[model samples]
Target: MKKINLKTTIIILSLIIISILFINNLRINKADNLSKAIVLKTNNSNVISSGVTNIGHQILTVKVLEGGHTDSKLKASNHFTGTAEIDNYYQEGDEILISIKEKQGKVTAVKAVDLYRQHWELLLFGLFVLILILYAGYTGLRALFSFVASVYIIWNILIPGLLAGQNPLLLSSFVLVLLTGIIIFSIAGFTRKGLAALAGTLSGLFITIVITIVFGNNMGLRGMTAPFSQTLLFSGHIDLNMKHIFYASIIIGASGAAMDIAMDIAASMEEIKLKKPDIEMKELIQSGFNVGRAVIGTMTTTLLLAYSGGYLTLLMLFVSKNTSLRRIINFKMVSAEILRTLTGSIGLVLVAPITALFAGWIYCSDFFIITWLKDLKSHLKFLRP
Candidate 1:
């Protein structure tokens, strides 16, 4: 049996403890004012109710009673249109479970779903974790732990900080740096490779932020372009700057690509070092640049595809309406999407070269540059003497 290193063992233990704490925290602070209830029945019609607008969509005022172990009886009003598939699943008197929260003595069902109660997704997720642990062992466990940590950071730290009227850009930048450091170190360990990847990732992230901020402002991409941003306004969260939220989201979205490029460059450099440890510094730098060139194209397209996938329906809407190209691209949401995709692409492009340069310099520093130059000078001096 292979002996486990003390550092690796400690890391594994720390991650396991943190994972437990995070899950417990989430469970404890979960929204409890809301109750899950079944949809005993639903009333739907085209006529607009008093104080409600039809808005070209069907309206339903669902009547529900508390479900599960709670015996509490309650009535809730929920808005449903044909847009979501849940509306199609509803039949008169069908048993549908809805999550309802109380406000001012009235219960409002924010989200409702038919509960046949299948744990398939949960089961699959558990199986995935198990397979990862079984095959990859400690590293797999670390990856899972890092993933959990990332989610916690985003939800518990970043979201709350942004909503609490903190500077969105500043808070997001800080979170990105913290998350990158934690994730890289957790997965790659505190080694030269991890440091190289971290440097590249941070560099890419900074460039992404700069590009996002400049163009986001010039393009008039309001933060309200994001889903639920306007709802936050009406929901009485004051002093929350929507524009800053958009800026933060841009960097967060770009960070994944930045990390990818950094890792790619660092990994390539590490391989080159292993194969030829005596490779010249200039040659190693060139090798990293070459690898980066190959990655930049597809990675930028990946960003484009990712951002575009979310807006396919919106694009179709514009086309179906016969909207002009200029107008379609100029729409607030469309413009925001464009800015996000392009800004991320720019970061990816710059990150390739920056990461390659840094990885080359750090990985081959001793023999490739300094030692080679010193040897050359000594040879010349001996010849002169």
Candidate 2:
């Protein structure tokens, strides 16, 4: 009862702290530089025609609904550019996001950036939460809290901190550690199992960090391999280490798989201990190793499939071009994907033994073993009579 109460109190306090931090961060990053707009009309239907490989641009007339030009609803003309496959064609009553420029407290210019689809996004998110709650019950609520906390930390804390020129490796590692502790303890409760899992998870994360740093350097990659990262370097008020960010991403990506294996080993060991209180330490450790082996098989395959799925189009393109297999394997993007998947899978494999050791020490008590042995001796003597 005491343990349960303590866990409950900690969870409540965590939620409160997270709520306060989220609101504060939201205020700090408020969207004051942009105005909400509704597309009134396209004043010029003529688009600047570009080559077949390029997208055309258009001009839009919009009514400013928010910002310094609030409530006036004056028509403003702006340039429009579509992103990826989405056309920047705005029809009547289509709400959109507009970047406004101000000079002398008056709106000088407006540019259409994208559409505002907050309502649809919220509906989808709500449905996801509903499904989780229905399937997992109270545990689902805990998982939901952890998921939201993680997203908030990534968006508000990690991204902002990186933009502020903080060291990506250090900041990211700190956040990963913080998140690992919160998630494991929240779901596993304040028990030996949680503690064991936490230890194993942290160890696995540390291993990943070291491996990424060492191998990332040897790969002769500068992290500019990301298409948008180069553009970001030219765009803003931030100086970032692209390579370090890449390394940090590798570590963070692997942390989830590591934590999963750790928790699984811890839970299985605890269950074994519960069913056989007198189970020897060696036997308990062996049971954990058995569980780890079973999980690692499917988990590694999952990593391979997930990493490959993202690059299916690229693979298809290579096939169409009749690119040699050696060239495709030597490609930078392909190598990076390989590095990420293998490193993460290795971390998952390591977490098993580490967690098994911790759980064995926690759940296997010498007192229980002694009692079981004494009972067995008495039974043997009585059977002789």
Candidate 3:
């Protein structure tokens, strides 16, 4: 009883420490220049068209919704860049993100930054949490906690380390380990199921890293194929290794799916073991392998479908252009997606077997020795007959 209590205490303390670190790492920088405002009025009479694009400055009357400038009405200007991708079209009653310039604690100027979407974002998030808790109950709640931890690790540890010019693979590997352990143990507890899942995820991810590095080098494409990667490179991070970062992204992207496969195998095997306490090691292993085989078939296809779906527009473009299969496959963007899909699928395939192997051994070890002896004696008696 004492031992159990001590173990519980240790677990609780460790969780507390991790929570503190996660909070500190995810600290948001409060910007004094930023404020939320509602677009009260917009004038488009002076707008002019340039070629196929609108190139005019929009004048707006915005009422501040936050800060000391609350309820203050100010005139704001939004210039059209003739680029639809970078511009926001605001209507009255639309909440917007804005930057305020102040002189001696008085607002002198304001500029619209973006359409404020936080209210809907929060509403959706709350609905999601509510649905998850209601459906999966405690397990869903635990999953939510893991989800939060993941956001913090990615935003804080992974992003900052990469920005600081740290070795991308190393930093990403550290992040992977942290996330794998936390996410798996948090959901599965510190039992054999969690251990098996963690070990399998790390091992599979390690293999993924190797495959990505080797294939990425020979692919003859810079990691700039990713959206915003080019922008990021030119945005004062010229020293960062975009290739390694891309490799890291592949691992990170595949990790969630890999964990799913591992958990499936581990959890299935764990249930099997609980039901059949005296199950032989060989039988248990075979059961795990069977479960792995079944899961991997769909899981690999699932990965492919997921990657392909995300690039549906690109695929549509290829179809519309009637591009040859060879040419389509050779395109850098298509090739990158292929690599990501195949590499992730390959890792997931391995994770199932690896997790099954470990879970079978760990779960069966305690009972297997005795079970094996009894089987051996019974077989000997049969031989004597």
Candidate 4:
């Protein structure tokens, strides 16, 4: 006669969804030609440096260790592009990605494309999981599940929708809401705390989208400012609306940071409510506000640092050129980034109060008796009589 826990049921359902996504992705993205191989011998006699460029080729004797070409040995060629960044010089015993050309049930040719880096990546990921689990125990497992769920949802749902030329606004909106629910609920469970975080996140995302549209439309900024945007435009999707996608990017990027703020406030207020059931609505709201204030300063800076960190080289290039502040801000690339950083930070700032208010109304007020609110109300009434 044991009652099944609702939280456990939700987690199980989420796991099922993730599994489906994983399997479907494998089916759809199956690349039979790409396989892992290990270098057995290297003939680098052709490789040489010529006028600030690497002019040469690498011939590698390799054995296929994975995929359809397992246990096959072949001579693979690694051509040098003369650019340091594009070249991959392999030593003996280096694992690499090989593209196998098969014709009529026989391997025609094999070429080394890049390094087979999944081994090290998996090792690093395992280390992260071990540290997380050791530090936080069960909560860490929940966090890891949420992380994987987010990745699968993005890879399976969002990217495909965008590539299919679906309305960026609609797709982004749907994805934002979906991710918010999955991430917050997976961690906090189906509780008022999760509701508060979800509501606050969506509300802030709306603001971000509106601000992005208003500013993005009039900023005289083209969608080409986005990295690799030119390549995409000429990829036969000329009719695709890059401007709207740019706008979507702003909101989508801000949402994750905003959700963190919302969840922090909501969780803090929930703990407060549990510890002091007799607390007034105003007092609880104020406490939530206090918690928000404590975190907001550092969070905004963290957001700025995160966005800026990616373009450090570009910023240094600007600085090295003695680019005037006036001209620097006027640059389209810099301007677009300015808007993105500020808009995202604004969303973070707004979600704090929004989450606190929602947590207050949901936890302290009697008018909101959805689900567990009734049980909470048996002893604690948030409304002032």
lDDT of each model, Cα atoms only? 0.74, 0.78, 0.84, 0.84
Residue-level lDDT tens digits of model 4 in 1-385: 6564554455557767877879787767767567889999999899897766677788999998977678978999999988776678898999999888878988787789999888899899889989997998657767877888888878888888988899999999999899888788767766788889998989988988888888888897767788778878798878778888888888888888898899999999999999999999999999999999988899989878988898899999999999999999999988988988988988888899989999999888666446554465454442101
Tens-digit lDDT track for model 2 on 1-385? 3344443445457667887888787766766466678887765555553543224455676777865676555555544343444455567788988787779887776667678887799899889989998999667767777887898789888998988889999999899988998788668755677878998988887887888778878887778776578778888844789888888888888888888899889988888888998899999999999999999999989888988898899999999999999999789988888778888888888889889987888777545544554565466432110
Candidate 4 lDDT trough over 10 residues, lowest sum: 376-385
Clash count, candidate 4: 1
Kindly provide the TM-score of model 2 when superposed on the true structure, using C-alpha atoms.
0.84
What TM-score does candidate 1 reach? Answer: 0.78
Question: Which of the numbered candidates is closest to the native, going by highest TM-score?
Answer: 4
Alpha-carbon runs more than 4 Å astray in model 1: 1-12, 35-121, 366-385
Taking the tens digit of each residue's C-alpha lDDT, what string does model 3 give over 72-123?
8999888888887687777899899888988898778788888988789979
TM-scores, all candidates, are 0.78, 0.84, 0.86, 0.87
Model 4 whole-model lDDT (C-alpha atoms): 0.84
lDDT per residue for candidate 1 within 1-385, as digits (tens), equals 9797664566577767777887798767856543445455455553343333332322333454544436554444444453443433444554445556667766554455445343566688889989999999877877787777888788888888877888988898889999998888777665557778888989888977887888888877668888878778888885688987888888899898888888888888989999998998789889989999999989999989999999889888988999999898888888898888888888888888888888888886654544553565465442110
